[model samples]
Target: MSDTTAYSKKTMRVLLYLQQGELTEHQIYSFLASRVKDEQNSSVLRRIAGEELGHAKIWQKLTEKEVKTNRIKFWFYSLMALILGYTFVLKKMEKGEDKATKAYRSLITEVPQAKQISEDEDRHEQQLLAMLDEERLQYVGSMVLGLSDALVELSGTLAGLTFALQNTRLIALSGLITGISATLSMASSEYLSAKNSGDKNAVKSSMYTGIAYLFTVTFMVLPYLLLESYAVALGIMLVVVIIIIMFFTYYTSVAKDLPFGKRFFEMALISLSVAAISFVIGILVKRFLGIDI
Candidate 1:
């Protein structure tokens, strides 16, 4: 029935609204659950599914008669809407996941219900997440991690060395040296490392990651050229470098479809590991070669 007639028809009209709402919720759940795959969220989606199943019972109580023909029509419309909605939401949800990842740490903290969702919602979220993650791993190889790793390693190396030198030009040159050599080496290492893996996008991912990183270093090194005091410039550049790197990392995640939670942990771990290793190398050089501490 037309909406005008639907209004006057009966209380049974709620079934139409309820069914439409259930499908929309299903689409949302499919997207969300894919993003956050777990039993709890799955359970939520399943529960919503159950509620939908019982919705027919509510109809039976209210209408006291069968509307098999109408029910079929409703199912047909729901299915068609699902197809159209899935395609639309799939694209939007991936973007949404990318956007959400930027605030992942806070998003989780902010959305207490993030981990929780009804079955219909879970199914919707899950489908979206799956589509996103499929694109994500292609974008996220170990190379993204490696580039981030290189940023911390080279930045710290340049920072500490420039601190010791306390000469602006030399610091600038040092940073440049560090930037080029580190970029090439890291990119090469990542390329070779990824080459061994079967990921089709590994080479491409590493190539872009290295280029993005090379650019990030340029900014980190730029401050040294402007400032007179090497130590001061190094300190200031450290902050600048970190911010630039983070922006690139977050942006890369957006392009890659990486989830909010996974993205943060992955970025942090890769960077910290690189820093820790570099720190150890610095210590070893100091201990063995009597390099200036």
Candidate 2:
């Protein structure tokens, strides 16, 4: 029997879709392998790329149709790898394969090779996980410490100052002074903590923490600097705080394979709760002292 005659139209379409997906993944892996600096990582990518091509060929034989690689997805993943690091982009691609694996399992009765293909997909994820070794991921803890502290501390400080001083310029000035001092202190603390723990990358880890903290501080204080109204600036700053938490939490979650919703909500709650308490204290202090600026 001919290849097309062996299956229904629906099955043929599914095979074609799987073939195209595998081809696209092959292209993406090949491109990443060429660009990766680490020899071991490049070797693993090349092996995976070859396996993907083989899988595509298997599907092609069954579908009896030549599938084209998805250029858009190929370039998108390439760009992401360049900007976000190879490990992150590769992990994201693996996540896409997870859905494909389920589809493959469903086709096991229609195609005997489907079970093997699904197993291969599962193996690819394991291989990628074992081989990935990105420096940024290594310093994620430091970044988290710096980012979380800055968000909570600066958000609260700015909220209090906004209510107490009721002046954008004074708030901005005070926030910057507070942020800078805190950045230095946090960096030094990270440095000492890493050193005590005998971490070889102590200096780099501390730098990552400090940079993350300073970056958060800058965004939080930007609205106050640009706007004249303290209340409006505080509102914008709170929005910025939420955004920073959302973004950083997502990055860490994706890179580390952790739960996104849990971490995001937890961090948001802590930061906003501190800001709310500080806002009330600012009002009480201002009213009690009868101070007006």
Instruction: Candidate 2: count the clashes.
Output: 0
lDDT of 1 by residue, 106-203 (tens): 32343333233233344654563454333334445454555565567666766555645556777688778878887777777777776787656666
* Each prediction's whole-model lDDT (CA): 0.54, 0.90
- What RMSD does model 2 have? 2.0
Model 2 residue 202 CA deviation (Å) reads 1.4
- TM per prediction: 0.46, 0.92
Pairs with steric clashes in candidate 2:
none
Candidate 2 regions off by >4 Å?
none
Model 1, position 198, has a per-residue lDDT of 68
